[model samples]
Target: MNSTNNRIVQTWIDDQLDLYNLAKQLGDTVWQEQIVQTLYNKEQHTQKRMQQDLWRVFDSINRKMLELFGQLKESSNSYEVRVLREQVWELKLQRIEIVKKINK
Candidate 1:
């Protein structure tokens, strides 16, 4: 796996931890408002972090793909970068299914 994939996987795992912590905190009454506020803050932070990570990964991938194209010395029309962008989407779907199963 590439560094970008590694980071995305790691971040997804870390987000699971954050989700657990937020859920636990939300169960407290006295700190309910505080917990909500904290969750909101963390949610925003997580979103931004995830977005930045994705941009970095995609940019790096694009650069590497261009480099590969050049390395092959194949005509531009002959070379097509077959990027498997669906892997991440599939992983996300699997994660959601697992979470739903656990909830049930």
Candidate 2:
């Protein structure tokens, strides 16, 4: 990957990581449980919508990584591939954590 693309991807991953941290904080907050119980149906609907949005982002990221992987196979940009792999891993972890929070 060119330096510009690398910077862009890194910035994106950083933003996603920040988002995950905020989400974790929100999930752990005391108000979340009360809100969950008080607004069960609404909470479920919101969670479903959020999950769908996350899935769409996840799918797009996966497709981009796959395309990058093809490029990597043709070249030898191990560092870029590693960075992309880490991003994918972190994104997947965030998705799992969000799902767990919603299910709880």
TM-score result, candidate 1: 0.35
TM-score against truth, every candidate: 0.35, 0.39
Candidate 1 segments exceeding 4 Å error: 1-40, 74-104
lDDT of 2 at 34: 47
Quantify all predictions' global Cα lDDT against the true fold.
0.54, 0.58
Off by over 4 Å in 2: 1-40, 77-104
| lDDT digits (tens) for residues 1-104 of candidate 2 | 44643554555555545655675687765554544443445444444555565566667656766775676577567788687667667756766764564454
**Candidate number with greatest TM-score:** 2
What is every candidate's alpha-carbon RMSD to the true fold? Answer: 11.5, 14.7
Cα RMSD of predicted structure 2? 14.7
